[model samples]
Target chain A: MNPMNYVILAAILFSIGSAAVLLRRNAIVAFMGVELMLNAANLALVAFSRIHGELNGQIMAFFVMVVAAAEVVVGLAIIIAVFRARQSISLDEPAELKG
Target chain B: MQSLIWLAIALPLASAAVLLLAGRRADAWGHWVGVAASGAAFLVGFFALIEMLGKPAEERALDTTLYTFIPGSDLQVDVGLLADPLSITFVLLITFVGTLIHVYSVAYMEHDKDRRRFFAYLNLFVAAMLLLVLADSYLLLFVGWEGVGLASYLLIGFWNHKPEYATAANKAFVVNRIGDIGLIIAMGIMFTTFGALDFATVGQLAGNASTTTLTAIGLALLLAACGKSAQFPLQSWLGDAMAGPTPVSALIHAATMVTAGVYLIVRSAPIFNGAPDAQVVVAIVGAITLTLGALIGMAKDDIKKALAASTMSQIGYMMLAAGLGPIGYAFAIFHLVTHGFFKAGMFLGAGSVMHAMNDQVDMRRFGALKGAMVVTWVTFGLGWLAILGVPPFSGFWSKDKIIESAFVGEGWQPWVFGLTALIGAGLTAFYMSRLFFMTFHGKARWTDEVHPHESPALMTVPMIILAVGSAFLGLFLAVGDRFSHFLEPVTGHVEHHEPVLPVPVIMAATLILVAAGAVFAWLKYGRAEVAEEAPAGSLATITARNDFFQDSVNRAVFQRPGQHVTRTLVYADAAIVDGAVNKQARGWASIGEASRKVQNGQVRSYAATMLVGLVIVVAVIVVGGL
Candidate 1:
């Protein structure tokens, strides 16, 4: 009923997605979680536009969705390459990216 | 004539370079080359001396610049030769005596494998000695001074196979370096005070210098002389220097290089004239050294070491003479020349004796050699006579003149110096007679295997020539007081004096004491049963035997402290210097190890750390806003 409820729901979704990305061992699941986090941000942007009665937040949300599409294309390609080379998509197994 | 002066040094230097460069290729004839080079230098010097003498007395000095030795904005030194009465006299002495020694070494070193190298060093020594006398400026003279010292070191250690011989060379070098400090400081002071280093300029301006400055310079020069001439405190190295070859002992140690200290004092007469206190110190040092050297000479069984001690005493006489102002300079040089002839002859004779006796230097093992080594005996006898100040011998004219001058001043000064010199003369006679009797007069002491024989003709010829000089040189030079007159242009006239002890009384006293000493030595050791080793008898005998314990004193004073300081520095360098660096590296390594634990190459750990930092930043921002 309140516009704040949508913002709160988006924040909860973002936290869940971040937790999945951090805790998951599989590379494909971690990538999916990242996309979910981006969508949550887009939802918050759209809700904020509605609350302000302006088009600025909605436009930012549209740009973010485009960026998410591009990110998905690149991210899937990298995961597929790593899976072929190592025969595994576990983030813990391919820990070469860690400091 | 001026241009030809350079040839005196150049000839021997070129010979040295050629022989050294040719190496083994020149081995067959290198010694001949050295001989010929020195001979040519002698001829050049002889002609140069004649030409110089032909000039008017006041016009005899010739200063010719060869090149710019050192060039700078504030200081400039020319590499030039000064051919004056004083320098020409030295040129003759160096070249003539050097030529004889070179020829003598040819035969003396015939059996040695390193004869070529030996000759090369000899030539180098002659060239440097010539330059020392001929140099116009203090800076150039210093170059020659160091040159001679280097040549001496090389020749002393020529037989480097023997460990002690090398040690002896090192000892001579280190001791000389101590003396060189005085010379270097004196030059620095002269440069500051006179604004010049040329002999003529310094001599002219030194008269106006403050007495304190003059005294410092004079004392500094005396220290240099003490080192080179082998006086008192520095006398220890001279005896050790006998470890070198016999020819080297003759030329560098006895005749030429050792006398350079005397030459330096005589040349700087103007400076000494201005510093009476410095002159007094010089005389005292001479007196002490002469007695010390004589005492040491009496105790040594080694023939070369005894001669070395005697050389020290003789140079001490020259130093004493040089200390007496204008009157002493001429006599110092006169004594230097005579002493050069006799001392060189005696050293060569010692070498000849050693050659005959399987190179054994112990006089106790060398008795009854008079018939076996006739030439050595005859020549050494003449040298012994000359050294004892016997009339008609070279030492009488020169040494007597010095003793006379030592008593010229009134009061206790004359009495002390005159009595000291007289006593030194007696000591000289005692030790020398002791050396002679022990070596040649006593019953046969050599083992059955020893077969003593005369040296080859080459060695004896030089000895013969030097013997003749030692016998007749004084009479020839002192006739009409010509030597003193000849040196007058440079040294100025010495004020005539009424003697403290009448001249006849002094001469009679010296003669009587010398005779008594000879008789005493003869009775004590000449007729007594000579032992393989002199018994360690009284405290005086032990002190003399130990070279007055000077070496022990030096070990305690300088060497022990130096070693302690060095050890402490070494520990500090390891503990502090290295520890500081190692501790810093260890600290960084521990930090790296702690940081490495955070980099476990795990994605979850890195993410957690990032989140924690983010939460802290957010909390701070929120708190500040509230």
Candidate 2:
């Protein structure tokens, strides 16, 4: 596939992940969706770096991966706490913070 | 003598500083510090007076610069003292009488918890009064002027626990401010005209100033004098100011504050001499005020307020004298000094009565006190005689001179002023007699709880000394025109002419009228019972009792209009200015409320909002690119 196709594929994946986060009620599912969106962005960054013949975008992708990994650790911890407190990880259940 | 002039002002100032700074630690004995300091200042002033007297006529007026008061590029003022004939006389009066009052206050204020604070304020007032008379420049005089006003305000409201006393203090302050504006304007005009603030330079230059300019200056000074001396329209405050402790009333009336007005008029004689029209107005004001004071005095049952009214009238006599060109300047001061003695003694006597009567101020409630309070009765009786212009008393020598001088001008001016003064004299005797008799002569009016007794030696001694002064000060000061001759270096040569009205005739007429007034008062109140509340009577009686409704007039003329204006301004400020600001805040708040709804704190809701924003941005970019 062409480098443009890779970018298009990553964009579609980002949209799908965004839809999952917007549609999902479960905390774990939304967190997984966020990770998927971050990976999709990394894939597009790498593809653009190769097409431009530059290391700047690829280097940026590496920083994104590291940030995503740290986000997973904190996100799962919060999700686990929610689950332990209420016996449910549903995002809808935590709407106690509604304005 | 010139170098040591600073000590007269400094000694009391230092005492005030020490007493104030030492605070409660010195409360037990701080009053003695005040007395000693004032006494020392009196000694300094005494030596200075003697030294000035010893100097030849040409060399008596001396000015000594202590330091630069205000140094600038184009303007400079010196912190100097002028020990001229005028100032030396004031220095002697202030220190001598100030020391006595301080001694009197020691016993008067003994029972009070804040005696230290009271003494400090007294010392401060004396220092300020000395500064007012001794300063070489108008600016320095103003500094001292404001200082005494502040000190009096504090002392008037010393018993601030009472709301009415505080209100009285406020009234005194606010009323005096109206006069202060006149002083400030006069000072400004004087500085502009003379290019200097020094009294010597201004006095010399005043003769050359245009009649219009001099008139403006004179009128302004008169306004200020009216405020300080409690003349005419400003006379109302003096009665209410009796709210202060008796010593304060005595000091303010005698040597320290009220007399400053006469001092100013006399000191600025050159200015008044140049403006004949202004001088005439001054005389007219004096005439009207003296009558008003005497008329009001007759109606008051409060002993201190009656004395206050008497003080106002006596100062009015001095003003009348000071207004009469060169002929009356010395006599004005002569009257002022004698008035100082008798008025102070009378006020202290009133204080002694109040002390004995459990702070009762009504004369109607004070009958049959003569036998019990022997010392106060005797001293007060002397004061009463002195004030009534009885023969050989201080008032006879001083007040009669003023009355004679009133007729010095030719034709109708003399008749109008002379007749007014003559009538005022009769009224003075009438009211003072009423006060004395109502308090001492009638059958016992006191309640069973009351027991009248003499004041302590400390208070009585001062009254006795002042009584002695009242008895002889005029005779001593008036012999061979010695007092007037001593003041000639400053006032210039006062023409000694044949009497306009023969002295013997004037004396006989005045004494007869005064005696007639006294007999009238004795017939009316001495034998009759006086009710605590004055019985409703004629229109004239009601008017006199209400101070001619001057306070009511002031309220109608100025206060109500001012309140309406203030209320309108407050409403406009609240609705318009605050409305604009609050509207902006409310606008932002409403927008914030709408925005706050977006933060539902639900993970899915925030994501959905972000997705919608992202779609809008992407769609805009795509459409633009196409």
Candidate 3:
């Protein structure tokens, strides 16, 4: 596959994910959108590295996976706390600090 | 020898430190500490003067550069001292008069609860003034300049319990800050143009610089001087400064702070001489101040406030003289010294009157106390004579020189100066006599609770000495060649003018003017019948009483704009600035709130989202990378 085609696909996926994250009222949809954006960025990096013949992209992807795992642990803990307090999962209703 | 200079600075600082450390306990001994410190400083100044005089003229211009204070490619400033004729003269005046005022304050402030703080502030003022006069560079002078302003703020609001006094202090400090901006800009210009801030170096550079650069520097310094000296528009604060104690009015207004502007111009005379345009501006500003101050003085009923206006008027004469170039420099300094003696004495006398009359400052409430306070009466009479440029008194001689130089000098400059000085003299005599008659000559005006009496020797003694100085100090100039010879090396060229108007002619003209003013005043206000008659509600009286409409104009123009700026612009801008920052904080807070909602209490939803996220991530990477 041409690296350019992979890069184009990744950019499209990232834009779609960002739009989903911004527009969705559901917390679960937003979480999936964020994960899709991160994975799309990782895919773009891997494609560029393959075309350039560098190990640096592979190393960066490995670190991204580790960071994503750690983020999941912290995010779940935060979700559990919020669930205990609010008894709802609506992102729109959660904006209690807005002007 | 260096230790002597250090001692002059250290004594006052030490007193302040002791007062700060001892706090209220310092009150009992505070007066004595202040007196001793200032006395010691005066002695050092005396020694410095003696040493300065004994040296060859070349040796008299001593420069004690402390160190390079600022290290930069473009500019460097030195913390230094210049013991030239001008600085020496100012040092002697500040230290000597400061000592007397300190001693007088010991008695004047005896009943006050915050005597320690008063003494501390007074000592600090002396040190700051000494630093101001003794500093060799503009930067060091500025340090002392601001230091004096700080001390003035503390001293003016010594009775901090009074809201008005506190407000007056704030007004003085803020007005002075406005002037300080001029000094700072002048400094920056000096660095850019000359690469030095030392008076001698800058003076040397000013001689060679283009007229435009010199004019820029001169104008900047002139603005600074106007602010410090309270000239024209910046003069309102001096009247309000009467809210301070009487001695403060005496020391700061008469002897020290107000003279700083004159000193700055005189010290930078070379810069001014190089830029004749700037000198004209100085002369014109001086003339305006003289006219304004004298007119305002005519209208004041309060004795201290009138004298405050007189101080501004007298400083105007000095500024006028300074603007007359080299010939006027000596005259300005001479007038400055003589004015210090008489002005300080007059203010002290006014203070004595207030002290006797149950703290009543309104001259309308005073009359026929000349017999009761004999010393005050005599000393103040001499001061009045000296200030009015009366023949045979100190003011007459100095005023004569300034006026004569103005007419006799190059071009039409002399005529312009002479004319203004004449009018200023006439008005000065008229107002000063009015003040004297109202306070001392007529029937007793105060009620039973207020009885006039003599102040104690502590206050009267300084007045007596100052009276003598005011009467005789001007005679030193009669031997002009010797005086000029002594000052020449420090001042560069001393322009000597052959008396174009014969001494007899000048003296006769001045004497006639003086006598005319005195006779007119005697007829108008001095006679018992005239004084007994209530002042008429004539337009002139109303104008004089209203400070010739200048105060109203100031209120409408400057004061209102200033208030608007502070209340509307500054307040609005501050609110807007703060609002912008607060909005950003709110935005961040809202984002945090939105993020918090994602963790709502639903385990099933969280699990489903995690699975969906996993599938999306896997699909995006696999499909995109294929």
Off by over 4 Å in 3: A1-99, B480-482, B498-503, B530-536, B562-598, B621-626
Ten-residue region with minimum lDDT total, candidate 2 chain B: B494-503
Task: Please give, for residues B1-626, the per-residue lDDT of candidate 1 as tens digits.
Answer: 65589998999999999999999999999999999999999898889878877888888888899999789867888888998888888888888988999989999999998999999999999999999999999888988899999999998899989999999999999999988998999999999999889998999999899999999999999889888888877877988899999999999999999999988998898899999999999888888888899899888888999999899988889888888888789999999999999999999999999999999998988888898998899999999999999998999999999998999887788988888899999999999999988888878899778899999999999999999999999989999999898888888887788778789999999999889989998987789879876677799888988899999998999889999999999999999999999999999999988877777787767766886897799899999895
Candidate 2, residue A83: how far the Cα is off, in Å: 3.6
Work out the TM-score per prediction: 0.89, 0.89, 0.83
- What is the DockQ (computed on Cα atoms) for candidate 3? 0.04
Model 2 lDDT tens row, B92-141? 88888888989999888989999999999999998999999998888898
Error of 3 at B157 (Å): 1.7
Interface RMSD of 3: 8.8
Docking class of 3: incorrect
Worst 10 residues of 1 chain B by lDDT: B599-608
Q: What is the full ranking by lDDT, best candidate first?
A: 1, 2, 3
Choose the strongest candidate by DockQ: 2
> Best candidate per lDDT, number?
1
Residue B483 C-alpha lDDT in model 1: 89
Model 1 over residues A1-99: C-alpha lDDT tens digits? 899999999989888887888898887787878888888988899999999999999999989988999999999999889889999887887566543
